[model samples]
Target: MAKRRRRYQNRHGNRNKTKYIVIGIVGLVIMITTLALTLLVKNQKITLKAPWTLEKSTRIKTPEETLRTYFSYIETKEYDKMYELINEESKQSVTSEDFIARNQKIYEGIEASNVQIQITQVDDSSELGAAISYDMTLQTAAGEISFPNQAVLTTTKEGNYQYLIAWEDALIFPNLTKTDRVKVSISQPERGAILDRNGNLLAGKGVASSVGIVPGKLNEDPTQDLNQLAELLKVSVESIEKKLSAKWVKDDSFVPIKTISKLTELEQTTRYTSDETLEKRARNDALLSIPGVMISDTQVRSYPLGKAASHLTGYIQQVTAEDLEKHPNEGYLETSVIGRSGMEALYEKELKGINGCEISIVNEEGKTKLVLASLATQDGKDIQLTIDASLQQALYESFAEDKSSSVAMNPYTGEVLALVSTPSFDSNDFVFGMSQELWDSLNEDERMPLYNRFRQKLVPGSSFKPIIAAVGLETGDINPEEDYGNAGLSWQKDASWGNYKVTTLHETSPANLENAIINSDNIYFAKTALKIGSEKLQSELDQLGFNTDIPFEIGLSKSQYANEGDISTEILLADSGYGQGQILVNPVHLAALYSGFANDGNVIKPYLLYQKQVQPQIWLANAFQMENANLIKSAMEQVVSSEHGTGHAAYREDIVLAGKTGTAEIKASKEDKSGTELGWFGIFTSDKEVDKPILLMNMVEDVKERGGSGYVVRKDKEILDQYFGTQQ
Candidate 1:
């Protein structure tokens, strides 16, 4: 009975212990549930997955987005951000300094600040990476450089998210490796050609040998190479040094010393071997033997007509620093040649085409690994001028040893057939480089060879009598048939002013408009001018395009007419009537003035560009009444056909030429009583059978020894005969 009771007590005690344990477990469960509820209310994220799965929850950057960011950093030059974005493997391979150095090499001679990068497209087809195509542009001294480019982006895992960009040299430029670099090569476009109306070549590109030195390839000191090249080429060593010392010339640049157009001429100047000997010796071998000296083919401006068209064609020269600064956005390169004057300058933009380039990947040895992209260069347009090459050549030769200027044009169309200013320079000399001695000679020449005499102003002398007659007839001051008694060889405002006599070359007792023009009667014209008064005479001159700028492609000096103030004095008015006062006119203006008479008082503007058909600008419509213009034309005809005509020497039986002659006295000073005279002759044909009536004006400066107006008239006859085929 005692053993049964003990077993029952032990059983009860075990049951109580088990119940206490169960209550503790229930309390712990309640606490855990309350904490979970608080966490849920706060919206805290709690992953119930593995650490690897947590990575999936974090944001992973897209390959395109990563590449866009990379490009932005590159464009902004944020090297820190760029470095951070680079893959760990790439960073380990290259240091920050190395990366910067590599970029510097890519734009060694360029202004990196002006570089622009734009991502044009992005393709993310691969699971691990993306391909980004872009365009890179750089503003250089040579011009704008634009090319298409491509890059690659890859993904990588970070702490909790996957980052993109497996950076490498190849990522900066597609197909470029860590060991490879990029090289840029520029190809210049062909400049336009200049042609004459006859389709004859005036100025064009010609192949020539350019002698230069590559400093990096030099086998000895630069001084030694310069000396050797100078001796071989028969040029001063200083010149070679000056060329190589240019600011833009780099160690790898090929510095040009000179260009040789005619090998025979070079041989003659150097007293060297002939072409046969040069060939036997091998031109390349001889040039290569001189340290850094090299010979390469280059384009040179060739003026086939030499000095015949120098003034019209002008010349081109290397662009200066001032040129670049003035035109920052014009894309002018330091190595470019620009037109300095004449038509070349007037049409520079049309003649200079777009320059192209090739962006390539190269090795350390300077070998091209791949051509990433290329742009084809565009050639410039060809320009054709209105000048008749044959007529121009003939007229230029006619000037011979004379220092003169002349203009021959079609009166009806205002097309300039010939515009010649004698003693012109050799344009070829300027193309290569004019020597200091030659330049000095031209500037010092007493004849003023450098002056464009055709565009310069000169006194019209008695040739202005026709304008005075027109003024008188138009103002009704005098009739074409009304006679103003010829006042002997001299006249004055009155007998009281006897010492201030106005002299004439003729002594006709009764001089009408025809008689005055035929004799070039200064006295007769002077009296007519007084009758018309200074106001009316000045108005007539204004209508004749005086004291106004002539609109032409090539610039012209304004022709001047005497102001009312200038003709205030009676003696001054008399002098001005015969173009002896402050009256000045250029050859072009004189031609246009006469052209009006031939076109029935409608003056046409002269032009030299044939491609652009410029409408005729009437300087003065109805400058003179039809009757007055006819009267002037008839009197001018008498000046050549009549027995007493001063320009009788210009009369052609077959051509029926009409003209005037003048002898203008040039005073040494305002107080001088007398000075040298300039002879002048202006002639035109009245034949309707001629396709284009030609008006020619010829002048001889300081004709003290060359005779007077008669001499100029005879010369005109010769020129006219040659031009019109009316030679006897």
Candidate 2:
């Protein structure tokens, strides 16, 4: 015990207890002070690097808050609300409706698939702004997906950091990120003005003041506003109510409900009530607020002559659900002026320009609190067409007599001077949507006004006679002066009794190609077809741009030619020689083929668009000249110049017009004259001064029993009258 006590006292006594204690206390205090100072400095400054080296020390957003704001939109189907929260700048560039519509399709297969988000890295004190990295595990209906997203948020003058517009995250989802929006305004393009070559306005988008509506801005009764709107706009109350209800449901804020369009002073003054004027105390308060019902500036599409260029220009319609399915990103609201047909459909891309948008913030009730993004709407581009409105009007009037069609083209350039489809409907019917009554009438008419008959199928008849004669002479089947006995019928059929017979219009027999075409002698041409054989004849015609379809801006029916495999007899040859049996051609195809005659045996492909200036030619290459094309031109010229010509009545010595006429029977029942025949006329000028021949072909279908000939004669005359005037 004494030894133990001595050891303990020695150990305690030997050490300087106060000094050791002071040293240990000082070491502990120094370590704590170092840690405290390190933590204080670390928490106070955050270093971050940006694209532009923007640097700042600021409080960072928590991962939870970011995820809540980002994913909350997916949980609730409030896509419009979600759009509002996007960086204001981006919101202005994108259409809210378009975004919602696009997301709706993507989200249809995704539900409550939790998105796991984690911040990986952050850079501070850099000119590029705050760099944030996120790791996300997204769950979709297809499978679980994971990806990393990053962005740099730039600091504004308010010290609040906003998203960078050109970043990877912005590319993937521009509407969701805070740093991806644009803040610039847009200027709408001026409304396009349409003018003819002579500077006459036929169709144009004109500037006219309009009334707009903001559905969220109303304080009065909905019915009162509706009634007031109806009285002001001179429309039914039901229509205003419907429009208002739609605006409310769609939640449109910027676009106003138009109460009137292109209003007169008298019409504008009638909007006020008598009670407001009589009561002096309430005069200032007479104009009650209405949601979406207000006057504003707007552009309107107008056709100066109303229906003058309806078919060629076509019309516009609001994009439907089908359009949305085809273009999910374009959205419904912005795609209002879709081209319905004609030139409008062909040039849609050039016409519709960039769209403008705005980003706005709304409260829980869907009230807009702030505009987060903004840009003005841009206007569409303008197009100048080759159609001549005045000539179009004149042609329209000429074809008004009967169901007929006419097409005029410059043989050299292939520019269409006139393209008229007869028994036509007023284009105004399609504008603003057609009425059920007019739509039914258009569809029910026997004339088939909607059909572009110039491109429709028809037997060429005697118009093909010149073509057959040319084949015979080229193939050495017949000499120019070869004698062919009429016998009142072809070699395939006997005409002993002269009952079922073909006859020459002239009493004497034709001695050459000129005489043959002049009288349109069926017997001579029919015999020529037999001698050359249908195979060789068809080959020559096909090579000269016959029986084959020609390509254009619109679809066309192919011309029909008898295949060698399809025919085996002289009887078929005889019928085809007279443009019957199985031969059919459109006026445009035949008119183009006739270019060979004027072009000195070289048939040029028919075209609607100019080639050298445009990247691609609108017409197909079906043009070629056979070794003996002159044989055809020589004969056709006589049909108009010769005294005994079938087209003698149409001949003009002054202009030297060469042409061929045809009449094809349209049979219904074996005994019915109730069927009509199509009459055709193809013509061109013979003057040397005319560098290129002008070609015109007109066709009139369904003239029967008026005469034994089964052709519409007056309609053919009307077409010739116009052709002569225009050609001159």
Candidate 3:
């Protein structure tokens, strides 16, 4: 019984020990589970086992990322996002609205485009802050701008963000400040003047009478006076009313109605009839008759030569959106004027001058804070032309009523003295803004007054005879003395010609080169072409600058031989010899060709730009033998000096004029009889006076019933008589 008691006590102790161990094991398991769960809830990942091997958290962005994102928002025009990417301290520097508005204004004003930014380098040396280096480029209106900049970033306590930018105006542009405002100042240079050889103002500054009405000085019941004023100024009543009702106009202010160009001395006699001039004067008197009608003189672009030199001087109009688009990066502005036609359009670059610009910082009161960059202004170059204004006016006046065109050149000096196309428009009217009625009249005119006849190619007619005769002599095709059987006015090649025959105006015997040319016998030259053939004649014409571009200040249509330089048949070749059958010559080119005759066989290129001194420029040196040119000139002299000659009407006693007359027929076929005639007279002074010598060529559209070339001869005579101071 004692042994049993001791074993039971030992068993009980062992059992107690096991119980304590079990309790301790269960408690240890619970503690470990709680620790694992707490770690999982805190980190949201199994990072407790290998914390160093795990990927870093992506919750907060780095300082470099914050800077890149801020610039990215700028590119997207998300200003609010950019503002949010900045720290609290930076936000205090500018309000959200102020930042957005400032950025928008600057970007839009400079027409910024193609924005680019690069994170050049990032010095992430400290945990609390970073210095990010960046480079940016912006294409602005002035030009492409590029700069390097630094943006400082700092650690932020803002939710879900680790870093933010320290905002400042310097981030917008290099060296930009809070008080400094970016500005672009443009300085417009003055437009150049167009002057003639004698310093006459062809297109330059002038004064116009500003017809305005003072509201206080206006007559009671101003309806009738306003209507009359509108009629006289060729403006609408509504336009006048609009000017009078301008916001800035006061009761005593001269509310300008319209500008009326004052008539020049030449315009008084030629631009209008006596009655019309009196009516214009009467309108001014009538304006004075109305109360409050004050005429104040104001400066404007003046055309002193008026209608006579309109084509030579051209005109100007306001710059358009299309013009600006077509010519990009070419210093153009909305307030500028562009050349519309003629010399003005041809030399736009030289006349417009370079505009000056300044990129600067300015205050609200326009006070300069800083000048970033500047460009000096360059004024336009003054252009002087070879045109003689007095001569141009006189020539235009002589044929003012006719559909005529004339070119007066100095053969000795190669100076184009005058270019006149009659029935012209006043360039001043364009400056003052042409009325609808006037514009319509100009367009509807049957004569095509707007057409540039001087630049046009016309049928040379008999005026081309001298050139053909010279070419014949040059190729040894015919001797000036050789007699080919006389056919008397009309002839044909052979039976192969069918009914087609060559016709002429005059009948003469012994169909030699001189007699044929003296009488302008078409059959004789047609025969001469058959003898010379197409190749030889074409070769000589090419040597004389045919089928080549005329090197004039203004562009000219090339003189052609045939349709694209093709003489398909003998008939066409024959027609070409007599200045017919697709043989078209530009008036300017023909004038240049004629220079050889008066210049001792040396054809000179016509020039319009006046230099310090007139330099004779040789175009076709020795186009023909000096002897051949003289022979033609000798016959031409007799044509005007002799009574029995064809051009006897132009016989001058003292001046000794020499020339050939031409009458070209425009026809579809040989059978067509109703075709119109182009009468021409090419003449030059025989006496060797270097300063006074002239090679003048004039043409009239129709002369069939008006005595053919004789009609042109009479007008030329009248003009020469006036030119040489021998009006008889």
lDDT (10s digit) by residue, model 1, range 484-519: 885888778777665788888678756777888888
**Where does the lowest 10-residue lDDT sum fall in candidate 2?**
45-54
Ranking by lDDT: 3, 1, 2
Q: Write the per-residue lDDT of candidate 3 for residues 386-463, one digit (tens) a residue.
A: 888888998888778878788998877778889988778888887777889999999999988787788878888778
lDDT against the true structure, per candidate, is 0.74, 0.58, 0.79
Candidate with best lDDT? 3
lDDT score, residue 634, model 2?
A: 62
Clashing pairs for predicted structure model 1, backbone only:
486-509
Candidate 1 positional error at 397, Å: 2.0
lDDT of 3 at 120: 66
Q: Where does the lowest 10-residue lDDT sum fall in candidate 3? A: 45-54
Clashes of each: 1, 35, 1
Candidate order by decreasing TM-score: 3, 1, 2
- TM-score preference between candidates 1 and 3, better one: 3
